[model samples]
Target: MPNDLQRFVFVLFDGFSNMVLASALEPLRAAKGLPNGPAIDWNICTIDGAPVTSSSGLTITPNASLSQISNKADIDYLVVVSGYGVRDHGTAKVRARLQNAAQHARHIIGIDTAAWILGCCDMLRGKAATIHWQELDQFADQFPDIAVSQDRFVQDGKLITSGGASTVMELMLHILTQQFGPAVAFDVSNLFVYDAENQYHLIRGADWLQGSGGDDLRRAVGAMMSRIETPVSLKDIAKQAGCSLRSLDRVFHDNLTMSPGKYYQMLRLGRARDLAQATDLPLSAIALQTGFTSSATLSRAFSKTFDTTIRTIRKSRAIR
Candidate 1:
């Protein structure tokens, strides 16, 4: 790595989410691709230097041990990517190590369950944050001081957090755009064939359904999620719910505070985001698979909603 490169240290714990790791790292790689691009450096690390396995059984070898890097002053960011047994890893030793790293690092990022680690480290106290949807209840129960939200991601000053794998790529792209200009970020996105306009959101599964107007709304949302590749219209969803379009709209307003059409679009976009962040599928293919008529259409709508492009989303994933 170049001497002037920004250094990023991604902390991996056992049973980490591979998707989160990919979402966090890919954008940095994309940043390096731009002409006269600023140098960016990243390395994977664990409590020890030993290889750690992902929740999906993918094993990754770390570049160095935490002990070696904990006190290093050169690191710019220390990102903890965790999943599953996050509470189990909240050992005193790990907490101390994180605190030591935070002393030197310019920023600390937590993805998915790793947010729990940050909370346990007392780094997220009183900060507005989010975690994976499934763990929201437990997270609140354990950390009452933290103001958690259902948003896809949250950034409180230098401490950034995402709900989980879904929001990790979005968070990374946000960082990339902030560090590198939109033009360089766009170039990086182009290489990945991602739509250039979709802003990333950190979504928790529960939030996706919360406030949905009762069983009718829940069923509509569920059907939409299950059939993202073949999106159904509001009218169709309303028919399935044995309600008229007007009734559907009223229910949606009562439950989700959005029209049925908007809800469906959000559902599709959410699924599209997950695929973009978690898979290497071409942008066009992803668009088609997510029920968009074309990549351009998806790009337009996604950008309108997310304020970023698809290319950036994919580029972010690529860095991971």
Candidate 2:
């Protein structure tokens, strides 16, 4: 890996959610293969240097214990992946190790019930945070000082918290989109055949982009999603989103650093890629669904965009 890699340290408790861990980490794995994707690496650890079992009985050995995490100030995000028995892992010793890790990390993320652990360490006080919906009421009652939200995920400054597995995936993708642009993020989403319709609207994904993406951004992305099967003109998209074409362009430009036309094309191509990777649909059918007039046009565009043909990806996937 390059020295420029973004390092993530995953501190997993004994009952960590396997689904949530996979959702958080798999996108980072997929992102590395895409053009201009994030240069990222991760290490999984436990409170002690021991193997931990997931809620579903999957056992994972740690790269190191929390004490082994270097305090070189190179850690980008210290992610806490939690599960049902959250309190079971929240001993004073565990909190001390986590607090030690937090000091070296630039940011901290709590997935699912991990927010409780973070709160126990006083890391989330005075910040808007969330937890797995199962513990929301109890968490709110426990920590009245912290702003509690029922949104899919919350990113207040360096403290990030998510609801569950799917929301964690959304949070990861939103991070990808923020850092690597919409195209790479879109490809990562399609790699899993993940449909994000109405999901972004669910994201307090907007908290960070309060000023830039603003209200118009979601509206514009929403409109684009609704017309994925039959793409409309940029003007029509802007009109449907109740914003001017210039405002729509500005939204994409400011947030994604890409033109609206480019983002729309990428979005449609992502749909085509999803079809190619997961379905045996004919090229013409795929093209029609993704707003390409013909397979020839789609083939050329896909080759230009992804640097691999639909046939190549299909053959590769088949061999796997």
Candidate 3:
């Protein structure tokens, strides 16, 4: 709502990966909590004013249809998240609409098979880009004039292209790093426990992490995520993460600016918030799932951490 906010329009098609969309958007959501991070706003859109289902069968009701995206509004970024059935989704009708949207968008990003769609719109005319690796050969043959790369994500001028879910996250963090700084990106990546996985380099090559002791913090956070329902002691968590409790505390303090116990509580409360926002399960069930002894105890902690009652938040979500 701020005047300096950057507006992002995400155009999602049928059979898109909700995970990929989350990978791209969650970093920006986390960045908003930073003291001086890039201020941004975003909307999800579809080709028509209809709900579209992801490849995993989750349906999403977008904020608006592509046609509703008036060119009068300043469009700072346009990200197209495409997955299965990408070829058919990029029809002439869709291309026309996307071209009109791009005219005002300062930065254009393509995820998964979205590069193909952008190419169809002539948005990536001379940009070196990539798509999901499965379509690398087809992409090369189809667009011989456009130089293709096997990297996870590539940026040329104002256009960006990403391969898959993990790369989408990397690309987003890259953008955050460029727009704000690496500290903001690192903090956001740490929130998601990004360093626990070993499979990220399969497509993207080596990681950007430069052994700055972030891996240890990520491991500790990963341990916390793993034991959210049965919260663990700082000593046990440090041991699981191959560090001493004191070292773990220092890592948490230095990197996250919180004590280990405090971070753990925040993690558990975050899980509670997600469950409360996204599910119909009762408070007792939610409390049990997030390691709370009872609904009353969970309610107090949730209200204290989030500064809002669960009932009020749920009612607000329903109203929206």
Candidate 2 residue spans exceeding 4 A from truth: 1-4, 194-320
Residue-level error in angstroms, candidate 3, position 30: 2.3
lDDT of each: 0.74, 0.82, 0.80
Better of 2 and 3 by lDDT: 2
Query: lDDT (0-100) at residue 38 of candidate 1?
Result: 70
TM values, all candidates: 0.60, 0.65, 0.64
Off by over 4 Å in 1: 1-4, 195-320
Q: How many clashing pairs does model 1 include?
A: 19
lDDT score, candidate 3, position 106: 88
Q: Write the per-residue lDDT of candidate 3 for residues 1-320, one digit (tens) a residue.
A: 13377778899998899889999998889878543346877888987868989999999999888869845596877999999988887688898988888877889999999999988888877779999999999999988878899999998998999999998988988877666655466657766654443433332211333334556766776688789899988899898878888888887777555688987887688778777779988999999999989999999988887778779878977998
Residue 155 local lDDT, model 1: 85
Give per-residue CA lDDT, model 2, range 1-320, as digits (tens).
13377888899987888899999999899888554356888898888879999999999989888778745446888999989899877789988989988888888999989999999999998999999999999999999999999989999998999989999999998877766666566557656753343444543333334346457766676678779888889999888777899988888777666788997888788788879889999999999999999999999988999888999989988999
**Candidate with more favorable, higher lDDT: 1 or 3:** 3
Q: How does candidate 3 fare on TM-score?
A: 0.64
